[model samples]
Target: MSTDFTDARLLDALGTLASTAGAAIMAHYGGASSIKSDGSPVTAADHAAEQVILAGLAGLLPEVPVLAEEAAAAGRWPASTRMLVAVDPLDGTREFISQNGEFTVNIGLIADGRPVAGVVFAPALSRLWLGAGSKAEAMELPPGAPISAATRRRTIRTRPLPAGGPVALVSRSHPDAATSAYYAGRGIGEQRPVGSSLKYTLIAEGEADVSARFASITEWDIAAAHAVLAAAGGEMTQPDGAPLVYGRAERQFRTDHFIACSGAYAAAGRR
Candidate 1:
């Protein structure tokens, strides 16, 4: 298959699914009556969005396997030897349930344990970010604007994390107590919270220098962001100071603890 096909066609398909699902989510925002899943709230929007993503992916890339969040948790890990796609039909379920608007539709093309292309669309916020290979780039989309980037545009790059007072991005919902304590006990900088894998952009664009997470994350959630961050002069690695890699054959497919950083944070994993 042509890599270019994955670049434009796949990304476009993902953007559409995300946007459509986001609309479904917004329509159900703040409705009463509760049915929670795995201790987290589950709204009609979640299933609707997942179904849309799943159906679209199946139609677009009929050959490649799909590992979607909702399905994966329910024992639907794709079994493709060649390549497969990982989809977070909706990331940040809490944010979506809370109507806080940080949720996103994440889709990544994973081949031989690496992300070839990733599309993250926050429909409610009208932002679209896609990254390919080792180079990830992020862009914002005006609400109701065409998804194509031929019109308005901006680029992203990593700025060094402040020294002695480093700026950090922590999880908005699933905070890692150990990671937080590690930074605070080390007497480092201030921490900011955001939803999903959006923290990758902070270090990528120089807004924040370091983002550490010891809590569980899936490969689909970080693969595309990893590419973008790596391309923007940053690194994503395990807390043990190893570069992040994929294709592990775990049933759960949990990602190890990692830190994304510009300059100063590049070495934090070493300690």
Candidate 2:
């Protein structure tokens, strides 16, 4: 693994690549989607965006391999490496198909099972979030604005839980009983339904306090936002309280039931 994987300039380039992929995705949004053999939905936008991200990452970091959602689904997975990039060109395909405008393009760098840097771009929302080293920030891209052009850039951090209770974010399409049960007696102030990795950004930016998922999820689905949350002083861990680790062969990139929480939630959990 390269020691410079978390370099700010490199992460910025990755962010731009994510934005480019997001543009490609928006071109095909709300059209139609096809079912992959694995029973997941796919569209031209997924392929086109993955191609753009793959090419851009190859040019920027030839030494690292990319494990992208569409490519992996097609059996194009590369050999496991300690350092690689995880790309979810268009996350929340169902949301896209339903025209909810909640999908996003994600690009993440993982080193030794830990995410080091990442970018998440919601093209329809004209928003972008990035994490590099110890810094996490968000930007508001104007309508038709280039990726490099943002009307505002702001540093983001997780806030302490309120005295009343913490707010929880749940998957809009895959809400499971387990998630609700987990917070049933914990006194969660509110539960919001959100799509894609944006849930992590919500917590990282302190818009929400925590997210718990009992359903299966892949590394690509959460790695990018995981980096952003971690940079913003949050954490993601299995229900048993172990930190979620990526690049696992036995599990095949599938994560177990886990919780992504702000510092406040994490501290409370330990009590």
Error of 1 at 130 (Å): 1.0
Q: Write the per-residue lDDT of candidate 2 for residues 8-116, one digit (tens) a residue.
A: 7777677778878888888887777889998888999899999998998878988787888988887777586588788899999988888888888899889998888
What lDDT does each candidate get?
0.69, 0.85
TM-score of each candidate structure, all chains considered together: 0.84, 0.95
Worst lDDT window (10 residues) for model 2?
142-151
Error of 2 at 13 (Å): 0.7
Clashes of 2: 0
Residue pairs with backbone overlap in model 2: none
Clashes of 1: 3
lDDT of 1 by residue, 157-219 (tens): 677546556787888988767987877765456788888767775577678887888776788
Cα error, candidate 2, residue 197 (Å) = 0.3
